[model samples]
Target chain A: MSRPSDVYLFGTCLVDLFMPDAGMDAITLLETLGIRVHFPQAQSCCGQPAYTSGHPREARDVARSQLDLFPGDWPIVVPSGSCGGMLKHHWPTLFAGEPEQERVVAIAARVVEFSDFLLNHLDWQPVDTGPATRVAVHTSCSARREMNVHTTSWALVDRLANVTRVVHDHESECCGFGGTFSIKHPDIAGAMVTDKARALEDSGAIEFVTADAGCLMNINGKLALDKATPLRGKHLASFLLERTGGKS
Target chain B: MNSQPVTLYPSRQFKDNARAALADTELRGSLRSAMDFLMAKRSSAFPDTDELDALRTLGEAIRQRCLSRLPELLEQLEERLTANGVTVHWAETPAQANAIIHGLVAARNGTLMVKGKSMVSEEIELNHHLEAHGIQALESDMGEYIVQMAGEKPTHIIMPAIHKTKAQIARLFHEKLPDTPYTEDVDALIRIGRNALREAYLQADVGLSGVNFAVAETGTLCLVENEGNGRMCTTVPDLHIAITGIEKVVEKLEDVVPLYSLLTRSAIGQPITTYFNMISGPRRPGEKDGPREVHLVLLDNGRSQAYADQQLRKTLQCIRCGACMNHCPVYSRIGGHAYGTTYPGPIGEIISPHLLGLENTRDLPTASSLCGACGEVCPVRIPIPEMLMRLREESQRPAGEAVDHPLRGQGAAASTTEALAWRAWRRVYASPGTYRLFGWSATRLRALTPPTQAGWTQNHVPMTPAPKTLHELVREREARRKES
Candidate 1:
């Protein structure tokens, strides 16, 4: 199939509320590539928190609202792998035998994570006009298992000529954001996040980049609290936009 | 049915046990190193990824075939065993299994028994029963012996005393053994355990062992172990008793080959164990030396319950390999003792519910981060994360709600406040207008948001909402662009 000229953008709840710059940068990144980005104002959360927490009834209700928002044949690009996974893999399971199953099947087929869209769908490369910077990419658990974006992000980052990828240990494990899990089980969550932060710091990278807003928020929140820390967390859109000279 | 209830570890206090385990730095260090070593070994075991995937597929199919004809295969096994002069006994519960073994020992006038590593026996609490009845039951496996001497249960399935360091074992042997010099050298400790267990093997009146696979077509019991103690326990004494769960039976002898290979490789990275013993029957008339009489006990401790359900039957296909535990982040961090159950880690969280009940193991399924590590390493391809989610759903259902699943309404997620909140959330997210209204109010009241959000604020800075929603900002940006 030929690539579409325009696509609908699903700015997940985390990006919509806590990190609006990521949402804006994602659009700018797409628009700079000659593709029109459409934002559906009626779209809300992807209901991953409820679905993963074992509340399927609430999850179905929330999933149905967004399932109808982007009704066109345009690819639905999401900035977060976690929300993208929910849309692509989990939405059909939530509406298995219902009348909305067809809509879910159609919508799920078009859902693509941000990095995956850049590498696979658009087949576009970034123009490297920025300074050299060494960064480590944090691939969220959902990205590795639910979507194949974990490997695609490496390819996406490799497009920048001056950007170098730093190696780290335990790079594929969860950042412990897990939506409501961090709040419910604080001690366990703290232990996990602590391990993640130490591993990223040990890599000697100046910035930690990830495609998911939840992980960016969680890791950046922790890194921001420490005054002397050398590392900064950046979303894939912002990092790509900045490195490609698309950030105006 | 037996009258007295068997005493098993209580998983109801899992939270408390995990807290205690996390507090101990020494244990955390041991578990971390052990898990890392095991994971690395397993990764290197299968050099060709395609070959490994093929083996896993074959292994899963073998198990599925076995379970599909479980009842018929079990009866065939009993008939074959009876024809081969090996008596087969069925146990419906732990108490019943204990009673049957006790009766056999009493009939033989046995006073002492040496045991190989058997997780089924642990589930039945056989050693405690024998002790209560004034009979001596000793563990012959090195790790099991250490835990038995310390008056503690085996924390891990494969490595019973993985929680202990060499120094701790040296101290344990020094305190427990008479006239024994304290030595922490690995070889020295093995010599100490071997010498002690050798003496027990001769003096004991009965030899007991656990079966890794019970073949039905032929009445053969297969065992795989690195230590020679399993062979000695089954061959040293005149009377030998082999106990295993009924689900361990497979349809044919050939089916065990791939499963056994996967078991050892996934377990500890061994291409094959040091000893692979296959016992079919007792000593024949012309046989030189073997057990005079052999007994096979089939323990059904809630395995049948797991079998009755379609989705849950996958739990029984486990070959008792510790790969899941070796890869689990939670198990690696807290160690097995924190789970407070006979079995621990990812497998324990899923199967313990069927063995015990959901009420006792409600907190276990929630302990995982659901990172899918266990599922990725599982030899039989059991979806550990999916099962965990199913169990979590079962645990949260109301006490008596009607659901098609077998474990409905058996969980602790039935809190009224949480239900009401989810209902309210459904209302807000289901409607775009309602969601926008809440989003506007949340952005406006960002300063009024609480600084401490329950347990999260204890460590993390409070996560306050942003000043404006992305849609609101996008609208303003579009209007300015139009004017320009």
Candidate 2:
């Protein structure tokens, strides 16, 4: 099937700095399927921080910047479900009573969680992997509710050869890194993530896995913070590529 | 006991706790059985009626209206209650609430007060104040009495003993009821509870209960419940004390209908609770029962602060059905004890900080998955997750070290990791052209992303980015439609 044109990638902040490879990998995946991808130079955070925290003004600033940066209907795909969820669910809220409601409505129609996009539009099939390894999977609230991407991710992972996957026992729990939530409620955040790390250890998989890096970092940090007994955190993309001997 | 709060982890914490808690053979078996039973029963009671949704909408509207005129309604209630042979008192805080109750019982030359299930009583720790006065207040609701007898707070709002096993209850029964035979059967257990509380209800002169909805129209007080104790509390005593938060007042009886309807369905999945009692004035001359004088105590205690903020006023719409808590992932794991307060679950977390001061209850907000399930399951449809997140924000924005937040750095809005992540994200994908170019690059490197986004790829296969932009496809489709 011929790929649709002008695929735009809105790499969320967590993916851009902490893990750029996911961004690059996403681009490669699109191009291989014959779709040309574009990156918005001025793309910034989705202003979820200010929005979730009740700071409508700051969120408006960030959201307006995002709207301006990606003006005109391009199906904006974001790597992190956390960011994508914010754009789709919260940005519209920012415009509830304001003049920008029209802008919010237009953009709201264009945002999609990357996984759901691939599964729905691309009819994604798990690529042939050379080898399979044991892995565990975690689903975040963002993708769980906004996209239902968890099922899609699991289905794709199940297709890999030589892979034994352990799904996150608490597939819907939060990592407690709710934008500014972690730093503000550090102890609670710490306690919550410690619990998550323990779940990963209990998953019986060698590696703890999830779709969002923010959740991964929070869980991994908690594992380190408490010196949790077992299981280590890894991203979904990294685990898939490991079997194929692609990036890692 | 540990001084530090028990934590499962940060973003992933609730997930782990919920999983572990759900995996517990005993806990899950009981929880699944109970939750399903309650949900099924509730649905059966409502029977897919459009009236239920209409009631919920009306309930939401009534609550919103009540919240808007809270101060006026409260004044009206106070005036009406006092005129109806009842003493009306107002408490600005929990401490004040406790002290008022202590003074009232002390003045009556009483040592014991019988209480029905009032979460407000728990908030104010009225029992302790009474105990200090050498008075012993007894809990009368079967579930509440059971929880009290076990020396623990209620876990679930409606079914306080949901976390307990039959064996635990049998043991508790054995210990608490030395004279009665301890049994494991549910009906037998209820009989024991009924037998034990009957004595307390008959003996106590001053009965205390929570007002579910206080009507200002005719100086009326309403208590909704399945148990008979709520009825007996306001009816059986010579003097009755009703402690209510100000937000519970409704301007008219019609407004209360919708609010009360949602309360039952959301709680225990019931169409309507077995009993909804409306009490007007005290017993008149020649009256065979009820208190000679009724007392309504309106407690402010952080409710006004919540009302001051428009975004949060929606929380007042809650009917205390416990649906939000029942469906909550966080409450499922930690139960209510982890909250360390009278209120538990999502609603508790949101209101506790305001009631108990953020310093003592700051941890409550962090204990959520932000799953939005609570909002969905709510009868009044309170946006609990959204409110909880807002509390997290309120706690963080102040930049206090060990003031409102327990930890020195806890609740700070800015973090190096989060800030750094934001900085890098802003550098690209801000424009359509760059976004497309970047998408192409990601697709090309799909084979190599594991090493790139290692943490994310751990559990699931990262789906390759879509081959076609939905926008592009949509545009083409639309253009073709236009041509046709």
Candidate 3:
């Protein structure tokens, strides 16, 4: 069974509403590799917010609307590891023993995060250009455990010429965004992100990148709030595109 | 430890305790360093991932098999224990267990009881009960002795005094111990505690210990510990009473091998604990130095409540390794004191609800970030994050409504405003047209969105919606492509 040449992009709710540039960069990257990308018109949210917030019934209703968006078995690529993990790992279990269980299983198989799709499925590689810079990589919990996209992101970043991959303390620890968790338990979330910010600063990296939109938004928000913070956060899609001389 | 059931519902104060703990910089530093060290040790212990993963699978399977046939196994355990001349007693609640133990002690006219570190005893509050009835039970474990002397509870299960520093322990010893000078050395502090406990062991009329594993086939109660105090407490005294939750029983002695290996490795990162004491029965004719009478008290508490439900039955599979707590981000930050339960951290969050009901422990399940670190490090492979989600759902249900879950009417339901808002959100996202309208409005009204979003704005910049939705940008791109 050969990999699919074309795929559909699940523009996550966070991407659609919060950062459309990332979603567009993902599409541009796929098309640059000569693979046709389909953006379904009806897709909205992956229901992760409701699902994780303890409203499983609502989560199912919202998730059910997306169960048939890409019906022809073309792979469904998600740019954010948080959303990709939800679709690939959690959706099947959420609908277990239900009417849509079979469809959920089939959909789960085709779902892959952007970096994972690029490196493993499409064999995408970036050409090195000599511009020395130290950059730190922040792998979201979902990216690290659920999809194993951290290794792919690391490989992608390491391949870029003259870019030193600096290691920091506790890189794999959560930034504590956790979607609603930041809002619900802001103190703990704030403390967690503060520690993450310090680690990034201590690494002396000019910029940090993450594949998940949730952590990017969280760490970036924290960095933006602190005027003295010397670090910047970017989505892995935008970072990869900039490094490879592709349009953002 | 109180003799009667301590209020398990004190988890309601979790928020307040967590706030106080967060403010304590010293506690935060200790917890951070301790958790980091323990996590690194555990990872280093299992250098071979394949072997560790396979062992975890076997450990999980053993627990599942035991729980699936729990009733049959319990009967088998009783029969085997009786045949071995070990008296097995059953208690359904904390009060009953306390009464049964107290009766056993009173019958023997026992004045002093020496205890090994037992979380179950803490759960039943046996020491306080014994104290009230004129029987003194002294904690023989160094950490447990310090906690007991300081008039505090065991904060961490394995490392009860983990929250204390060497200097603080030295101070505690000088203040509490008889004729003890202040010495800020680790070995000196251990010597102080050892000297105090050695006399108690000899003078203790009865010995109390907790079981790490109860083998049904062989009727052997296995105790895992680094110190030999557990052995002293169980063997040196004339009478010995070992108590454990009903869920600790396994089908055969062989099943304990993988579990013991994982427990030791995951617990303190040792290939094996210093002592693995397995006591099948009291002394027979020629046995030189064993207890004359051995008593086994099987306490249920709320274990059957957890066992009756299929999804929650996984809570019973825990081997009390403490790896989950060590790796838990929330626990590391807040420490165990904030949890205010007999068992604290990830395992406590899932199991406390069953013992104390959901209404009291509602905050505990919601306390985690759902980071899944606990699940990854768990030796028995307990799906902690999944259970937290399930408990969250249980918390949002209305009281007395018809639900099939075992924890249905047991929750402190969410406020009406929260429930209504969630329902409205479901309505909006269920339809594509409605979602598009909401998204468009959100983008247009981005400027009006509050700069201060529920305390998040205090540390983070305000959340600003993008100027245009992806759908709108895609449509514009399509129009340009068509023109080209």
Candidate 4:
């Protein structure tokens, strides 16, 4: 409700490794926006692999560790929709009957995805990014269903006068990363990502941006495999940082 | 529809329907085109609205309550229906149902019965039996009309004539109605169908309809549709026979409220349909146009099996929104004709075998790609893929191309390749130690491997064993944590 005593910046595993810039950008952006960002060094994977894999017990074990590490009224600022979605939508399901569920539920109330934070809480006169360019937005299913991130992401993107943001037509479909689903069931995953990438190429846009790194990686990997060009997948935080001219 | 000999269970004939469907390039193309079009139309109608999930949750709760006390509700419905001066009958099996229906028609010495689009009637093959007994049954629905004219069964539940291309339908209509020029335009086709069926709706001695849901408290049967033909079928005729299963009952009127929310959304993706007519005990007190004698036949058939199984019983809760059908990848590829049953798609695959018999209908369960999209899109959150898996276990069919079963039970034939594959899986999954060893070996083999598996891996990908097994990764990480 009030200012976060400490903002636990959840740089999701994908962003932490693959697109470290988005991780750093999220932390810096949050601090600049006047929230104290705390990166808990103890944090590991959010156990989405276990949860979606139908291993609920293992997922709960991972959820409990995160629950213990990140406590109090601190807003858990998560950049990736996949991880944020897990925490927002699925963590409750994992810790459903546990007595400690109350604590997890309370923490969930304060957990805000990155796009949600900028759009909902901040009234930003978005720092003078030299100019925004024609952008295509791909909202992850998790972001759309779990976080309600579209209107928020759009409003934030729209405020930048130079950004000509266009939403993808088949944007609602999954990119098919689905955690380990890509590696485990590669054919279906490949077909799904191929479909997503083709939709991106057909959109007639120069750049594509999404809120989830898992989606970005899956799409980018498939894009590379297919050798389809002139469109690239980028994190929303990365796109935002570039538009704002922090560092490209 | 590839023509195949019909036989009983896992026979040379029955499993051929799915094989024929999968092999038919033309029909598969038609299925894909229709599904993509319908799904797009639905998505456009319900474009990321707030009303979606709320509606489904309410529907799930209502349908579940209806199925739990279905027997009691049916009795209440019967009493209420009888009190309203309409005749009510109960049919425990398809034969019993047909007999009861035949007895009623025989009492009237009926020659012709106008039929609305009733899946239950098809399930019971009532028309064939009636025809055998010297009664003509006319299909009133335009899609049903087209299929009947062509001597073909309907392929899709909602889009019955979907298997027939516009061109094919034009040919059927041309043969049936020589005066009308062959036209592929849907509007013209509908008009032609209306011109043909309009007379039959008014002339038939008895009308027949399938109940979508019957409210037990009020004895009200809801018949929903886009066309008003159902209304004519139920009301214009002197006697109306409403045939439905016992699972269709709900304890109270209020229960209908919640399911209606999900029903319309799932069926056509509208907040509601164009028409949702609820008829309670037919006609009363000089009711201008409704049937003079109404009969609600609660046909059991095989629904009691679903009610008996704890996990499967919730299947009765289905509102037949056809959302599962709409989103099913298998249905999208093969169409309903491939299932070779009145019901098709994920829900159909699970329920059909019980109605049709397990041995012959094993192919329906195996037809799935197991993508779980149907489960995700289901309005009631039926966990469709899970049920499909359960059906697979119950089935006597050979393992689908992707599944490798090492230990085949008695009387179940095991092929050499299948045995080898399962032996490999059994060796791997027997223990974590073996699993890790297999994963390690798989990584080494990855470099020498071709792009796809030798046989099964072409359509589906073989599982990629990670660089480190999950057990190893977890243990190594925990050890590192302890050291730190």
Ranking by DockQ: 3, 1, 2, 4
Off by over 4 Å in 1: A225-230, B1-9
Error of 2 at B211 (Å): 1.1
Which prediction has more favorable lDDT, 1 or 4? 1
In the range B199-265, model 2's lDDT, one tens digit per residue, is 7777786899999999987788999988888988888878888998888898998877777767777
**DockQ for each model:** 0.63, 0.10, 0.71, 0.08
Candidate RMSDs in Å, in order, are 2.8, 8.8, 2.1, 7.6
Q: Report clash pairs, candidate 4.
A: B9-B359, B9-B360
Give the residue spans of candidate 2 off by over 4 A: A1-4, A17-35, A42-44, A47-67, A92-106, A115-139, A146-248, B1-55, B79-85, B103-107, B399-484
Per-residue lDDT of model 4, residues B311-408, tens digit only: 77767777676777777655665567656677888888777766755655644554554445576667777866556545644442344533322112
Candidate 1: what lDDT? 0.86
* Number of the top TM-score candidate: 3
Q: Model 4: how far is A173 from its true place, Å?
A: 3.4
lDDT measured at residue B170 in model 2 versus the true structure, 0 to 100:
89
Q: Tens digits of per-residue lDDT for model 3 on A67-127?
A: 7789777989998888998999999989999999998999999998888888888777678
- Predicted structure 2: lDDT: 0.69
At residue A150, give the lDDT of candidate 2.
Answer: 64
Give the range where candidate 3 chain B is weakest over 10 consecutive residues by summed lDDT: B1-10
Please state the CAPRI-style docking class of candidate 1. Answer: medium
DockQ of 4: 0.08
Candidate 1 residues B347-462, lDDT tens each? 99889888888877877877877777788889999888778777877777777777665672285655787778888989988899998999899999999989877866755667
**Candidate 1 local lDDT, A182-235, one digit each (tens):** 766666666677778888999988897899998888777777665558687889
| Superior by TM-score: candidate 1 or candidate 2 | 1
